[model samples]
Target: MSGTGDDFKWFGEGFDGFPKRLPEDVVEYIIFIINSKLSAIQTRERLQGFQRALATLEKKFLKEYIWQRESIRMDLVCDNRRWFLRGTTNYGDSVADEWLIVYFLRELSQEFPDAWIRIYDTDGEFLLIEAANAIPSWLTPEVAENRVWINNHHLCVIPVSDHDNPKSLAIEEALSIINDVPTKLQHLPKIEQEAFYRLKSFPSAISENQHHATLPIPRKLAYILRSNPSYIAPAVEAFYLRDPISLRLLQPEKSRTQLNFPPESFVSVSVRFTKVLYAQLLGQQWVPPGPYGEALAKLISKESGVPSVSREKAEIGIKVTAGFEMLAQHKLYADKKATREIQLLLEDIEAGDEALPSDDEIARWPKREDNEGWLDIDFVEFEKELAGKGAGSTTRGFGDKNAQDNLRKMVERFNKFIEDEDAGLDGAKGLGLDPMDIDNDSEAPPVGWEDPEDSDDSDDNEDDDEQADKEFEEYERTFEKFLTLSSAEKSALLDDARELAQVEEAEKEEDEEIKKLSEMMEAELFSHGALNLGAKKNSGVKPVMGDGEGRGKAKLEEFLEEVDDNDVEYLDEDYNLAENMLQAFKGQAGMAGPAGNLMSMMGICFPPDADTDEEFKNKNKDPVNNK
Candidate 1:
């Protein structure tokens, strides 16, 4: 008020007219700014934005809000409409003023019963949540649902009123499709995009097939197969995946739903990467931090874009990436080769030494069978079980007339997958030990097993031509199929090559992510387990980590079991114990010289370490120390 500038003139009008024109809302907003100590210009900026929102609100409040869409019921004002909502991005902070406007309109909706607030992110992302006096669902089936989500060209409507009701098969199938859309999109790189599109087009295509192409169903499928013959059973499997009993396709949408304070505001998160920031203060662990923070710290440090992003943008990115732990069951990956993968996965799930698979996580993956032990699996059934839900083998469409074309397409796709994975190239490069390099150079010093610079058989001129021929032939044969492909095919193959380097790159990234998740679980487990173990482990004294006690004893037992299983073989009752002992003795000495040397060979019966009674005094004794 003291300033003489024209800007000061408007400051008075803002204070005066906003209260009169919007008495209820202006007072609160003005007080909010004053309490927060906003500057004169800052107050003016916010007021202007508020006025503009009002201007937009004036156009359609009473008309649209009179009777709710899809209903003849008279609309009534909901008592509370104020909401402060955000996505799980940047620790749940709203990125732009549009969100604030959304918040403002939500409040305004309460003040005016005849207002229908429609708000969506202009960015074409984030959740589109609609709030009104009432939403239509279940009990109010004639009316629209509480939420209509249009995300990434996908529609998923959540009818809150149907909370306790069971949906019909059609709706559930549609729901499943939307629910899994994100994973399908993520795995698109593994399969051709066309195959996915064809699967998704089924609902419409199947109906069409009934009307237009019913008679030539097999022939039409065959014709479509001519171009993409490799699609095979997987495609048919995906097509029939709408089995009502098991699977359906759904769009994948990341969501957050909450009842805000004041109980009037409607809140929803409709997308995975919505810009709701999570406010993580300095020094506190990020809302969901890994238990072992080393990996997370490295990830944060290695974020090449972190330095380049502004503080505000970095906050959003942090929140966005935080939601990446989508559901992927490791058990679904169980196979004969699963031992290595599972062991590697469990390596991260460790807190010092104990395996940390959650009870629920391992419940049905058929581990040691849980003291219902001595497991024997019918591998035929085990393979089916291992495929898990929504596996490629979900359906047996291979028998359909489309099998031949599908097989070819699958073969081509698999070959391409291997090429894309560079599984073929690595084998080719394994021939780096080129004998030609040594053979072509006559006077070069020979490479020796013990010493590199040792004169390479300089005195002997025996060049093992046999080994060289074998190496060259093997190398050629390795690449023979790919090499013999036509030029066009080769060009296609090269185009698909992309780079094998990415496999290692992705694997390293996956390992880091796994480590990050493990760390979070690790810290949690340590707090729950280790903290409680100190008293039991120490016996009111220092921990004895090396003796048979808490952690050490457990670890020792596990190691011995692993060693025995790996290094020893067992026989059935058919062989007598004496015979087995004799057989082992025979492998050791083979009765090679005869009984004439038996006395001198007493060295075999009396091994060098035989007299040492102390060697195994503590052998297999439980380790009694805290580890």
Candidate 2:
């Protein structure tokens, strides 16, 4: 790979052998992987696909693909506001390739110049699939409105991840922790391990028994190293295998190129280096060789206080800032063309050629004059007021204990959302003017609020359960019991039904005679002898009966009316023809063959009113096609 020109400046990582002129689909696929919109299985498959794509990436074309793909990523990092339009759930070949971005800019520059760009991707996968292939018009019902209004000063950047992705990188950073055998991650110092955990898997716990716990779970995991040194090596090894997020620390390798942050994710840098440094100090292979290893050595030496430097003055480690701090540090203002100016400033910083503005200068930037101060709204108080849980707590439907509990939970959930986004909200600083005071109602749902899609899903499942139970109860025996029956037992049931039906048939002397006569006549009339004599066989057309008429009586009357007795030279011929016609045309009043078969089977298997006196009697003498 050749070195890139000085014009392209990404010194830290991933721009070393940049590509040029590649397929847009490749870029889109990279974006999809970054979005982490796939399942554990899907993400694994996707990562494998990416690895294969990279492996097969014609060495000659590597430069263009890397450069173009990175360009899209850099543009996103440069201007957070453009992310207002998210990647839609349908993420096909739509990761907004260079040309796509250029086209979007062209569209905006020509028309809807003020439009905040939208870039949502789909399964194209959705924000979270409530079910298959359904992308919500809006991630949140409140956010669902077609329009998204982002103030120039405080554009929010929502971080997304593939919690289930299992791919890992085997770069210098990951490999340095071990030589060959057991892999000595145990010596990777507590301080170093703490830094990594805080960045990669912070705010998570194996189990949280305490309510309102401020998820310092990664810190807790870090604490384990200090508490028990022997466990560190095994834990780190297990973490690497179990947690996909740990891959963020490693360098860009085939099949693993998505970095977890901008140029300034200190925790990530610190953690990756800690492992390599631990091995370097121990005189191991130190496989990953790069400027990053040198930077880490310098950072550690500075922290440990060099030969002449005082330990007190040396930095302990890199400190990470909140999202709001990042916004303020950039010094963005809601002034005209602010996004472009901010991008330029960031680019300059990346180039190491621009000096940051002084504190006084940054204070002069726009401070969200029209924005709502997130702290002012109280969702819980509002819920209590609406439900009257306290003052008139017992006055209304709140009397139901379950109702009160539900309302309380809803309130807590809404409030918890505010707490989570507090960092972003801080960046949305008020210009000292009250937004609610200016307008009675704001369209926005409380910050970080999500639609109750889960609850709806549970309700749907419950409805299905109730319907299944109702149908199940209609059966004489449970399905399990039916399944347990032997073939002989099942056949014996048929024998009993057939015998009982035969007895009933014998009792129906008046109708049995007609039935037998019909059966005999059909055989004789359709015989080869009768056919050669030019005698007409039964037409097979069943006649319809008038209201309330018995099927047997109706069929007999129709046969008598249609009979050509004069044409039948013999009395026997006339009788046979009429009987055969009536019997052959005896139909189930309105059922197709399959339905009639099913009904008959069902009746025999699980007779209704089993002990009823008329058990063997026909219920539908004249059948109707129920379907």
* Local distance difference test scores for all models: 0.30, 0.31
| Residue range with the least summed lDDT across 10 consecutive positions in model 2 | 206-215
- Candidate 1 Cα lDDT to native: 0.30
Instruction: Please give each candidate's TM-score.
Output: 0.14, 0.16
In the range 1-627, model 2's lDDT, one tens digit per residue, is 012233354757555545342232332221222222444455345434433433343242222121111233212221221121222121122222332332322223223222223222222111122111122222332222211111111111121123722222222222222223212222222322221221221111101100110111122222222232222222222222322333223334522543222222122111211221222222221222232343335545644222332221112111111111122222222232322443454466558775544335433533222111211223344456455354454434333232344355445444544465433632222212335555656688678754677698788889999999888886735644654577578668767988999988788986888899766654553541322323343443222222222453465576667757585455345444443423323232332333234334544211221122233245534467532
The worst-scoring run of ten residues by lDDT in candidate 1 lies at 259-268
TM-score, prediction 2: 0.16
lDDT of 1 by residue, 1-627 (tens): 111222222554664332112111111111011113445455445444444555565443322121100111111221122221122111112222233333334444444332222233322212221111112123122222223322222333443323444322222343343344423212212222321222333222221211000010111222222223222222322222222211111111212321011111111111111111112211122332331133234334543322222333333232222211111112222232322433444354344443333324323322110111112222333334333321344443222212223343445444444455423533322323235545564777888565535557632323566667889999978676665577589757765664556777899999999999767644543443332322222132222123223454365446446664445333111112222322333333544322213324453231211112233334434678522
Model 1 TM-score, 2 decimals: 0.14
The total of clashing pairs for model 2 equals 36
Quality of model 2 by C-alpha lDDT: 0.31
Stretches of model 2 off by over 4 angstroms after superposition: 1-151, 154-627
